[model samples]
Target chain A: MQVLARHNVAVSGVEGAPVIVFAHGFGCDQNMWRLVVPAFEADFQVVVFDYVGAGGSDLAAYDRDKYASLAGYASDVIEIVEHLDRAPVTFVGHSVSTMIGVLASIERPELFDRLVLLGPSARYIDDGDYVGGFSSADIDELLESMDSNYLGWSHAIAPAIMGNEEQPALAAELDESFCRTDPDIARRFAAATFLADNRADLPRVSVPTLVLQCRNDAIAPLSAGQYVRDHVPGATFGQLDASGHCPHLSAPAETAAAIGEFVRA
Target chain B: MTQRLEGLPADVLCGYLEVGDDGVVTSANDEFLRIVDRPHDEVVGAVSLSSLLAVGDRIYLETHFRPTLQLHGEVREIAMELVRPDGTKVPVLVSADMALGKGGQFMRTVVFEARDRRRYEQELLRARRAAEEAEGRARRLAQTLQQTFVPALVPDIPGLEVVGAYRPAGDGSEVGGDFYDVFQLHSGEWVVAVGDVCGKGVEAAVVTTFVRQSLRALAVQWDDPSQIIRALNTAMLQHGTDRFCTLVVLRLLKEDDDWLVTISSGGHPLPLLTTADGEISEVGASGSLVGVLAQPGLADARYVVGVGDSIVIFTDGVTEARGEAGSFGLEGVLGVLEAGVTSAGDLTDNLLQQVLDFQAGEARDDIAIVSIRVQDDADEAPAPAPRADVEAKDRALRALQELQELERLDEAE
Candidate 1:
């Protein structure tokens, strides 16, 4: 299936070492793990990849029906792990990808050794008694904000953002290319991420799991993180001093330290 | 001059503010303070920039805006809304850049009121969504209209393997003018017809339906292929429409161990005949176009297709399909046949796939193909079974037959 090329998979660190696969969240690509990846390189074989419709992955492979739900994204992860031929690897996921990792691990429990969910949320919209931190109307408003900002992302910078092979240097020169995605694809991904309900799927996890919550996180609040930790069987909970949804980006030292301690233990 | 310079930041039309690394508002001009409707003392050194944003905008800041700024050193013209102390929202366009200072890294930002621009952009977004929805509805309507012109399933004709394929031009959003049908006549003979109308979209679709239905209605009454084409031409001429169509009709009748095939064309491409020995040739005689002339030249060609022989009929969409080299001419069709396909399904599939690949997967015209092969005896092998298996197989077969009968009853309704 050319899984490595399809996801733009990048592998580094020691050969034949314990593997750690990092999956990015909805807004960005594998580059989100740049700071933390360096911390794992000395001892662990670190892997990172862009999901379809993001970064340098093949856009022709994006199927609207296949990617309409989080299951489609989970299938990609399973394919990557199977294709890597590496079983029982540790998985680290951020934001919406945390739920994606959980789904994948549950579907193929033998492929994963442990799961690290950073700023995880089982649901983003508030339910009857569950406080997911945002209302349904707020998510709609977020989609609107995405639409308004798409004006700057339209044609002028799209070629560079797409990492055009003809002008590789131009794509490489743009630091913003990591988070920039095709606006239409991003809109679909946003809906699939924020509107997903995976609360019921939590207790099905059989792997050893760790939930890391960031203080003052706006997207995935502390309560949502606690809900995930409470639901997943034998899941350990930790809190980071980082003040945003992205601890790997905002506080890479502390974030990597916590993950390092857990993996080593 | 010094006093004027100090007042410049306060008097500017856009609001200016600065935030420390922790996102706390460390400084704000009078204009910035007024935009959020907060006193400078209460806003600066106390309020965080993220707290001033609406909930949705706050998420946008954390997910998109902040990441972009941290990576690119700046973010420009991001649309967001700020919540005032009284809860009124103010639409604003914000641009910010991060820089290192003596106090540590801080962000300098400029905010401009954009209520009018936001309203205009919202209108544009709504219009785009409306246009997309209308396009989706039209495409579905065309598809349903197209299905009425083309038969859904060809009846299973004994002793003959019949297969047909149709591909719409471009994205299938507009109705294509190509259609094919296979049906049984009252005389127990089978008729296969392929046609192409003059144009595309709703107008051509109307003519296509008229021509196809008229042909089917006339076929049952007449036994000769040439006579059928003639009657269809006269009916189209009297129908009072300027649109014309090209057609080829074939009549198949089982005679002893072989099938007698009769073919006629009305300004349509001739159907191809493939013998078991790998011989390929055109079958039908050329005739004048239907509906345009009072006395259109029409004639029938006859051939006996024995076991291991096949016949293929198609629209000009196949022969006239444009490719990088040129049109996929009659040679292309012969080339596919020359590849030695064994079954009716294989011939139709190979021909269509070659044409599509030749055009790099985009069909410039609608393509319709129908292939009929005289089956070899060895092709239909009976199934072997034990006593227990036979009983189970009979039960499953009875269930399938019942389901098919129910489906036919539903269609009748």
Candidate 2:
């Protein structure tokens, strides 16, 4: 039988319970949130879907140009939340997806209750009067590297691109699935997600926000996390014991607990 | 005439069967002659096995086909060009299975055509090559554009000497966002600034240019360095994206007959100062980085420079440069300075050279370093006496004048 594209968006708890939408960052699909999903499954309607070209979603839905920016990913989150017809959903995003969720919540404030940003950065480059941790030069070098190793674009770069180094090995059979993406689609998504800057939308987010910063992420450094807190008005900034870019992959239990308490409150 | 095999299924067994010891066609089914396209009488006994193959297939059959088939009595899959009597060539996968007699000697040969699979494989190879070429072009263009933004040399100034160097990052195709500019402010004071923007590409570069230009304007008109950072912050807030940038700006003033360097930082690394006595120290200004926070306070540092002292200002590319084990950091910068201890003029060249050597001569990020050395003031020197030869000439002229006076007196007499 031909494999059918299916997205299992489930709500296991009571119907009237609060909704929590888990948006995964680049490189992986909604599967990264699996470790944290079970914690809230009993109390909240946990919504998850493959972002266009990832996981079990229809591969035909991914457009190279549209997904070349975080805005496109943010649009997907908005659509999924609205489709579920949930009120005041809580969005928990990792890495650049945090900015994605922020932009989405800013557009439709009534759709979200609070934001749990895991390793968020408004900008990655250092400016004359700002310290974004990495500079334009650093990012340029990274992009150039990806272009040079086009043949190893998926199998080689994708593994090193996201998640944490503490858990070096792939979780199980996940590595194959991670590299199984269409390379061209992954390239476009990488360009869009990493290169995007959403500092402007930080002030526009009227919803309550909880920024869970990884203490030591090579990708999202501490300075960038502080920038997110400083810019987003009334946003709570809390440093986690996590060490890598994907806290959900490394320390999901603690990450989920933090999100759960914020959502319940 | 060759007899047609009656029981052979046409659709399932589209391939033809060639029967004989020398591989001459004894008989074939309807599908067999249709695939190879040969007249029954011509190919039945007279045709050599190699007659159906093109030149390439003839070479393959001679070099790789006959030996394996005769010795092993099995011909594995071999892609060959099949030649029709009409002189047209079609690519086909040829697999010959040798059917053995009671004594285990070869008897009949069955050849199956894999025309469909060959066409699919060729198409896949062509598409892969096209994609590779496109990626190569994009990488080349990105590298070329990145080179265009980096300045070849720092500006030349009298009294105070300045030197600058920029190293691009490891990834050749991505444009670096690290930039540094040393220009004489409109007020006649020299303003030197080095900063790293938040990300890479054309957008970050636009911000780099805006920040560089804004710094120059503010350094000329404004007095306080922190106020200039504030102005830049306001300007960036007006049109800048969510991304912010960090930088270190220094304004050099000729105060008390010696150079006084006023340094300001917006979450940038402190400037390293090397005195004439070879004492090295870091000037600290760790305030909040610009654009990240509203009304951010920029840290300002003031230090006096004696004659021959130097100040080195650099972006994180110089400090966080990845050597064999991650980043080299500030110690790497100081180590280079300590090993090759020299004045600012030589320090800039030596420091850049050391960084190049440490990175194995290939820079991974845009590294911008500006070294300013205070020199001995020419105005403090005493005027030199006239040369002895000129003095002798003056004495000779006086004697000639006295002789002329005597001659004139004789004339008057």
Candidate 3:
């Protein structure tokens, strides 16, 4: 286990086999990528770590003002890569983490070879020219709902997690999951994750990038994935036939095949 | 070791089934047949996927289900009430996805028992309702507490009529602390005061009550308006909490044909005066808020109120009340008085209504207004027109009186 930014990091597989660092998105810890990691563990070094404020991480180390901006997370990635002494490393990030990976790679291009950004969103709000599904007022309502139902956070967040109505309601499981987290920590992490805007960093990534987009991801839409592709120069875009936000859990075979081929190529 | 799939017991698998794109049932495990209460061969190729649903379930599947699948391409673990061949309903959760091939597409659906979820949902609904009720009760209690701090109506004064009003800051949420009071002092001098505390909630309300009582006590002993304010400021500084308050005090004395008003202000708005001729102006005051600094420097100004002349004293909630673009401020107060709300009750109600209208019913601060009209005392023997007016009218009478023999000489001639 590796300690990254006060988090307990678990790394498996062989050393120097094209290190694929898996970065998970908001609300979830590193365990969401468990199904995808095993596929590459035999041939490549698989690195998985919870974000400082998530999963089985040390909750005491989470700083509010420091984690207020996504750049703080991006800086943590750079430090993690530096500590591993791995250059030209491939980073596989999901949801908002995809944007964080891109920002971190741009800051230190020599440390990374390529990026695999899954379900990326440059801006969640709709402006005059951009429509990222939700509006400022919508997000405000979401925040109010979260605040009002703070005790039942898991159940409250289920609709937001499964933003697509196609999936069955997981309110029961979600409510239980929410109970696992300390309400104060979850509130702070929620503010940090959903409230961040990382549009400016998308253009700065000079590394070869790949976006594995789900066809009907409720949390992230296809247009948002296309926006990421358009912004990152020479970035490859691949649409997958997966439904949920966590494709590794829903359609592991397709996600593994796509990620495997992209890293090999 | 009997290998149960993934190292679990064989009986654990409640139900499992696979369906084709054309709604044909191709395969089913033992557990699936047991859940549907049907014979294995009887169910195969005989029933469509929608056939398993009841009439109500079919409607949901058609409207909310098919549209979501068509747009998003796949769905998983959605709860449904399945209809058995015996016409009995069973709750279950279903998950399915589309597989793209050389031909077109195929659907794979899995169903499981939903006993746990149904119970959990019922519990969640119950808890949510309870929480909502508690929140509603808290809001009502806060509102009731807020009303106690404000008076329902201002008392009428004889000889000179009086009007007063108050508005607390609230926007569909918690209440605030804004207070106004008019009490007759022991010396028959009426003391009118309006003030706003710094913060909100029960704490501010407590301080407001204390201030109201303390100022009333000080007014009884002190006749000078500025001295009363200074004494209140000292009392607040000594006994006040972390929160501060802004106050304005006015002392009214009945003068013949006019009323002498001694005004003292502490970080409060100036009083507005409307003359009998319909001209309006703000009676400005210069002082700091009470309980903040050691010496608030209370400033007192006097004004003579003639017959039909009315003066309006109010809190910032009146002046700061939002208009269409700018604010009501001193201008709105003057405009309301100019409309001729002469009686105490009318003036109070009209001014309060004007503020409420200007704010568009969104008053986020407490406001207080007190107005008094001066009555002309024409019955007090008229004061004999003074020595200056009498001296100017008759200079010849004075000169003739100065010449000692003027009256005798005039008679002899």
Candidate 4:
């Protein structure tokens, strides 16, 4: 399959302009950036796509061995950018995707001009002296929490949410499905996201970087974000007034404005 | 109506709470206040609903639950926990909806106590994990048992090259019935056999083990290919196995500069013979099914294969493999052979890869292939001396001829 089709890539905004790709985090699809996408549509060409197992992308494309590490996700990003034939493009990653962008930029630094890391944590589990906010038990509890919410991820619900002809009203009501994923895929993704430690890779980044840290974020603690900033050379840290792991969802206007300032500069 | 509306909080069985877009609790019913073990005044307009949840559920709310509510306008049966003032957690099922209220927009949530359900689910989860572990153990055991049926390494014959490949069907979680082995018999001949049992899993594995062991034992005592297979069939019947098998056996013996190959089949696919110029044809005769009929039809076909000739034998898994176009039949095998695969390893590897590609990398049946090729004379540069066994056999034949001549001369005198 074409990399663009494999990733379910959607490109919009001004053509022939500098590109900005938006990559969502663990729980949601590209719709996580729906509120912030319009802010850059008039000036820069915008790109948004779903990871293989998360959204409308081909579920058959999810190979367990390939996606076992962050590097596999990084390859997807590199492929998408290469397909666009637009080098030195800006990448905006949230949550686990932050490391994905970091790995991608490190591998092919020429393909990326800048990176915007939103609520990113280099590692979720605390290692020795470094504080990553949650313990290993907390991650297990988080998995259990996910298990309890399997009702939202049923395959039976996906077709209806994707726009079933028999249930037009229900389909129309949820035209923009967000945070819907296969339960098994979600469990693996959660493990990959939480168990990964990319602290050693931060210094290898060569692109201009921006770290957007949200206050009181449960998933990515402030220290984790600061660690990313401190380790990545010439990285700028911007604190958002929003409180949550997903500032782009909770406080979109502020989130977009912060990103806009960094990208334009 | 006003009085009923005011009394609904106290009358309802489940807990209810309303929070604004900012997630702070704006209103709480008496049932909710009781569930949290907090006074009504302390909860309403004082604390955020997220703060009332456990840490894991709090993360779930921000990452999954809240985004789901915002995009779909409602979320159903989300499992979460509510923390009490005493730091105890109340397991609950929450359903919330986004609605436009008198004060801009708010979320109305209903909480149902689910301690029993949570415990039940936990048990189910544990059972599922245990079953998965058991299946993993079974799969590994099956693989180990399967390795015993095939030779770890094919004995290196001086003039002949041999290669074998096997792929289990599906995700390889269950044992497949197909097996192949290349081994040297005590009679100074190489025997190659490929067979498929009637089914899969541990049951088929049992039959495969029996067949492989029987063939090895029979090959050691018997020189004729047909006789060895017939003996194996008799052994299976005597053993009273309900399963049946299809097998093809080839015995190779050095004949001067060429190798004489004897092929026999018991309801197995015919082995293909490829010439140096890529001409492909079937070599073995069609035989009856094994372990069923009292008198099974079996025959041995012989062919002399010289340098740059190959004999490819495989289970039905190869020709019967279904794809988008159709089953990869004998024509597909011939097509691959016609493409010019000169070596035994190349023939086996290419045929397996072609079959897998035909089926889109998902093998519905186990595939086993064995190929034997007589190496080209040019490839064996400095020719070595003949083997001692062959030399001894030649000397014994010459001695018998000279003794017969001497006995005839003495009788004439």
Candidate 5:
């Protein structure tokens, strides 16, 4: 009950249905999964909730100590699973949540069955020989970009990448309805997200994993996605034809079809 | 001139391609031809949309774009860079969805150039980063400067327990004018004082520094609280600084195996004194503001306090503190004191917390608190003889001292 209130947990669809928990990425809330979740509701129980400080999650529940790293958020995911008394369900995550799901699966394997990593990157910044796409300098620029462009963050990054040119309303709808983050939480989350290197935890994930490598995803690039797929043990790698970090939003039906096929398989 | 579609414009930099089941561009309009920086014939039945993207982007198409286009026949605001014929990149946003014709379902992509917008976003990002860096630097400097002037920790004195804390106000952006001191004299007496200089910023802080220095110097000359206040007044008048303050100087003296508190006030709030039986009341002398007039006569109030009893001295920042409701007035302060505290340190901390909590962790004015209590070891166990454990503890103490020194160096850096 406490965890539900804290993270604003929402459950819909058939109660006894197989559960599918959707976790949104950085600069986003559970609503980012809205485009794809409708198709899943008919078959699977859809679960969506915000991490503290994002979307409708209680901001006061955000503790800097607990939220200082990805492990903190993973605990929340595990808690939500425990809170609902459901586990070994389909866990789909986008961007940072992809690794968050990975951490949760490792910490409590009983809580998840299949892991869907959307635009997952084992590491974001370039290390010794690993090519994680963005340089440390580029990350600094991204953080600075977040700082300078308050509303333009969603406007430029969300819309530009998603190409709302056809129906600008969709981009505007996302701006008003999703990816809205508290500034302080967003900044700290940005630090935790980009600076994190979860390469070591990949091979430890014991669950069946699927990597959805979004084409032309600037934030979570192709190589990064491929790196995660290659490292994770027994992980099936499938390339999505959709462009941008959030295939779930940009190309919902195709993203879902892949998950549906994988889950059934 | 060609008639544009309802929402589509010629200057919009838009294009459409009929991508077949194999994901090859079977046909393209001239505008679509111009956007990709390729000849119409070259793209027709020859190239796929994935061919126009970077390698990393092509992988993206394999995973996300193509599948979505295949299933839903559309995608939106997909950020990708298209390679023009000249090899220069055009950073554009593309939107594509499928439309059915006589052939199988094919995808049509619309493109908008984003070079200018990207540049603007980058500039905004840079400015925001610069501003954040400046704020971080200023905070570091303020913290360092705050530490340099004030005592970082309360002085540890045996028998006489002292708890001292200072909370700076307003996000700690600027230095406050509140100052406190907890030091023991050579005469076995502890001198604890709390003061708030009028106004704020560097000027008020300068006056607070003067008061702190002058009070410490005067404590050497006299043990009487009233005389010390008078001496501070004389020194401030001689300095000719146009500043004033509210101060309370308290001397904890031991006599006849009992402790007596001699307190002098300079237009400050009276200190709270509660007995061992929970009888609480304000007890302190009164006088005009310090350092203002040439002549300042401050009275002294001496009282005997038993063991387990405490008195709390604080600045107006406590009682005058603002909360969501209103100011935590004298009544509010007394209420906190009424709920008896165990130790002097705890009492001081409790009172400080009440004010801080009242305002929900926001300190609008600088606050200083001093609580001195007598030890309650009357019915204690006898001392044990030295053992091997003592040697271990001694080594541990030395290690702790070294670690503290290292910490001090870290702070200095």
Candidate 6:
């Protein structure tokens, strides 16, 4: 199968430049990296793509059984890396994909030069002494909230696109204008993202790694960032001055500069 | 913030806040202060959006809420639970909109309590879950009923190696209306019949049961498959149900070193015959459907099962299965069988697995496959190789090797 077309992959930047692959988090598509990708275009070959079922990917290629866990998404990252046809990649994974990049690097170490985990969390649910954050009940509430929000959003967005039926081209583009997901798929993805426990896979990350933690992150606590740095050998943990889960959107300049400094170092 | 905040309900609590790009609460209305239970002076320029909720709700807000508002310019109807000052969890629907102000882009957000809507949605969720559980139970019962329709074991018929496998459609979620049975009569004749009802679920399962009963009873009295099918048609017409079944009945007789196979069909697919040299051909004749008219037009065709020759009879589910390219019709079945097999079990398993591997996902229909072989003096014959598939594999391996060599040469240079 053509994994490129299946993933709706887009490649850009100057030829022969060092390659950087950006994997977006759950709930949205590659558009989540729009603010961060352009900063590297001058000096790097940037590759941005969508995870299946979330963006303009070939929906038919999505298999529910394969994608029940994070490994399936990790496999897609490896496939994308294998098709890069250049030097080892500088992989940037946001949110859930941070763990996905870690897993992919463990499986194929030669494919990557550096690992950048944006707002990374190894485990979301708290265990005995590890405070990964959240509980089983909280995860359920998150899924329920997602369902209600998607229901209202779909109802509001559908007619606005349909009203411009005179231009079918614009309507087709507007279909994915908002990174909307089918509710059932989003629920599964949310469960996979929030319920995954990947603390054991930390020691296996052999590549040079960067853990970028936001100042006021609720999804991944400050303790979680320290845990990642302490666990992964030779990993450097840096603090971004931005808040919330996505510093790339809230503080793209700072996020990009921190990454550039680390890559150059 | 220049845009006017209007068109909201007066009674509903609407909190307003000016959020910085880094998600700090730069400004707040009295309603916002009351929602977070923080004093106006303490809240502004000091708190982030995630500071209002408990740890769990904070996670939800950070991952889902703010990212959406940042990217889409607005996030609507976000249901979040805030920890009130008195340590009570308040379920509220928060909506936020962001726009550019004088110095930087700031957001104006509103929060509304969703206690009543939450209660109504909880009731609806409970109802939906209960209905799903009941459906799961009913489907299990239908599957149990379907199991008793086919024989638990194929009777040990001497002088013939018989193997059959039945795969229900959708992995036993729905009761398949297809069934098959094999047994030896007292007069030394082996009688086998495979049939499928027109529809599915309990109703088709009922038709399958009736057809099995009629075929087993009629085959004992009459030797010819045509006569047995005619009697079955009459029985179904008299039973007076709006259901129909397609059937293929075979009578096997071992004569000398060969087995004589006589088969008749009632609007069923033709049986495939695989010879010793690994060639497949369609045998048997098509006839009128059973239970459709007063005089059923079923026809019989004679086929010989020599040593290393196998006969396969299956339901329409096998022919109608879809793959990446298209349906695996008659030609697809032949392509699978042409690889040849040593015994009945080999052919039966090979065909089922190949049909499944032809598609990336699950088979879309119920499959019933029965293959009978006339064993040689030796218990098993060596399975014949499919020339085309083996050649294809060889070519692919060679191409991979060449590609690896090219990569090595590039590295050396």
**Candidate that scores best on lDDT:** 1
Q: What is the lDDT of residue A263 in candidate 5?
A: 80
Ten contiguous residues minimizing lDDT sum, candidate 3 chain B: B379-388
**Per-residue CA lDDT of candidate 3, range B132-221, in tens?**
775675565455555545444444455676766666665534656677777666576677787787787656766776787788789888
How badly does each model clash, as a count of residue pairs? 0, 26, 2, 0, 25, 0
In order, the Cα lDDT scores of the candidates are: 0.84, 0.67, 0.69, 0.83, 0.75, 0.77
Residue B166 in model 1: shift from native, Å?
A: 1.7
Candidate 6 C-alpha lDDT tens digits along A1-265: 4888888888888778998888888766787777887888898888988898777887787788878899999998999888776758999999999999999999999999999988888998888888877777777767666665444323333343344454566456543544566667877787788889999999999999999998767788787888888888899989998877888878888998988888767
Error of 3 at B178 (Å): 2.1
Q: Write model 5 residue lDDT over A1-265, tens digit each, in one string.
A: 9999998788987888899999988766777677788888887889999899886888889899999999999999999999888777899988889999999999999888999998898888999789887788767755664454444333423333355466566455553434445656777888898889999999999999999887766667788988898889989999988765667755788998998898867
Reproduced native contacts, each prediction: 0.32, 0.00, 0.01, 0.34, 0.00, 0.32
Query: Against the true structure, whose TM-score is highest?
Result: 1
Q: Per-residue lDDT tens digits of candidate 3, residues A105-203? A: 978999999899887777776667765755776556545534443433333223333554434354322222221345456566555655666777778
CA deviation > 4 Å runs, candidate 6: A57-72, A85-87, A125-178, A182-188, A195-204, B1-13, B30-47, B53-57, B81-83, B86-92, B114-178, B186-188, B196-201, B213-248, B261-413
lDDT of model 5 at position B207: 67
lDDT of 2 by residue, B1-413 (tens): 99987656755665555545444556566655666687677676766556576533442343235433432344534556567878776656555646755533333444566667656755764677777775675565455444434343455555566777766676666667777776666566767787888888646655665676577677766776776777778777886577688888888777655777788888888889887777889874666777777778776778778777778888887787777766778888888767644556577777777676778888867777888877666723242233533443354344345435545755986
Q: By lDDT, rank the candidates, best first.
A: 1, 4, 6, 5, 3, 2
Indicate the worst ten consecutive residues by lDDT in candidate 2 chain B. B379-388
- Judged by TM-score relative to the true structure, which candidate is superior, 4 or 5? 4
Model 1 C-alpha lDDT per residue in residues B269-383, reported as the tens digit of each score: 9999999999988898779888899999999988888998999999988999898999899999999999896999999999999999999999988999999999865564343
TM-score of 1: 0.86
lDDT of 1 by residue, A38-112 (tens): 999999999999999987788888989988999999999999999888788999999989999999999999999
Instruction: List model 6 lDDT by residue over B15-107, tens digit each.
Output: 777788766789777776777787877789887767777554575566556665665556666666777778876767777777888858887
- Which regions in candidate 3 have their CA more than 4 angstroms from the true location? A1-265, B1-111, B114-134, B159-161, B170-172, B186-188, B253-260, B304-306, B322-324, B338-360, B374-413
Which lDDT value does model 6 have at A218? 73
CAPRI verdict (incorrect, acceptable, medium, high) for model 6: acceptable
Ranking by DockQ: 4, 1, 6, 5, 3, 2
- Candidate 5 has an lDDT of 0.75
TM for every model, in the order presented, reads 0.86, 0.44, 0.42, 0.80, 0.72, 0.71
